[model samples]
Target: MSNMQTLRFYVTPSHNCSYLPDQKAKTLFVDPQMRISTDSYSQLSELGFRRSGGHIYRPHCEGCNACQSIRIPVELFKPSKSQKRILNKNRDIQVIRKFPIMDHEYFDLYKSYIDQRHADGDMYPPTPEQFHQFLVEGSIDSWFYEFRDTDKKLIAVAVTDHLHQDMSALYTFYDPAEEHRSLGTFAILWQISEARRRGMNYLYLGYWVKACRKMNYKTAFRPLEMLIDGHWTHYRQE
Candidate 1:
């Protein structure tokens, strides 16, 4: 029998239906800081709880399952010819993983990315304290990946969770100045490669919204799994 302890809580619905039109949105959160082991935390992730701040959350709307938990099978992930081209385009960039730390450069890049990409989004100009709380206050296994150019200029950053069987990409941001290179796509490709190198199976990408073009890009990765009706089902064009 599985020995994973669980916690339950409900969040008030958001006034604006960001993803769905004229629909109320609510969520259920599991706090990893509250006596949850890394293994159990990974199980919750498989059950579709996305790590944010320090909490694992899955949608619990009254009548909606639009928010799908998505993952990439590292073994079956074959970069499309275009994806390979993107990787080759940015081969000069270097990636490093470390415990999350607050700094001005990261904050600056974050702000720039948000202001340009998500001007009306919730986290437009988050302060350092708020960024730190969102990225560093968790008790579960978490870390940040920093990407820099040869001159050590910070270009992109990803806040990821290392699960027992997979790597959960919690959040990521990149310099708008590098838009031509498609840094966002490169980041995911890099994670998939890193996961295979570390002997991990899956890369948990949070969600995919067909209506949201910004999110539609996630579907470009082949051999992905989408959670539906309490189960993860594989998806591939061919």
Candidate 2:
């Protein structure tokens, strides 16, 4: 593996913020042309960088620092009452981990999720090209954890990256009709268990925006550590 110290970094031009309205945001990203090693990727993740398809980046907005990277220390984590309920609720769902692929079943679920839940977001009008590029195109060590029901129907998919001593929960999409199941929460809980079982130390959750309601779900995971001013500290909710 090439030394990560040799990797080049770039900064994207300021653009409209996705999490905050009327705010501009920029990103600090590693050179896209480089094939980052698993160790290097994990190291970057520890420093608050995230993967989106082929890009490894972190929020680098000039004046706004709302995007804080978060991770759960698996050994130190304990599920909340609601999280346990989610696990119980999803007992019938089977999770299978496989290499990332551009399968139709996966894309269909992703399309349904983005089209319905995030129509107002940038990924609306989902296309196969977009789906493939966003989730399956990355060269990093990634896997797709398929969530299936008793009838063996695909319900949700969690794209996760296995890093050096941790795992990163990249993105998750599920059946809109299964909203009552809280499959998203279940996916995270399962990842936590899986990480612990694998002897990994943490599960990196991309970022948490305090002012964004959509990001509120991230806080429910107790003992979460947030990267603050280049330090990872236990997050205390206000």
In TM-score terms, which candidate is top?
Answer: 2
Cα error of candidate 2 at position 67, Å: 0.6
Error of 2 at 213 (Å): 0.8
Expressed as tens digits, the lDDT of each residue in 1-238 for candidate 1 is 1236455545756655567667777877664446667787788888888777767677887766777889999999999999999999999999998888788888888888888998877776677887877777774778779999999999999888898878988888999998998899999999999999999999999977666666888888988899889888986554
Writing each residue's lDDT as its tens digit, candidate 2 over 1-238 gives 4558899999989899999999999989998888899989988998999999988999998878899999999999999888888888888999898899897889889999998899999888999999888998875789999999999999999999999899999999999999999988999999999999999999999999999999999999989999999999999998
Global CA lDDT computed for model 2? 0.93
Which residue pairs overlap in candidate 1's backbone?
none
Q: Candidate 1: misplaced stretches above 4 Å?
A: 1-3, 11-15, 31-33, 236-238
Residue range with the least summed lDDT across 10 consecutive positions in model 2: 1-10
Q: Candidates' TM-scores?
A: 0.92, 0.98
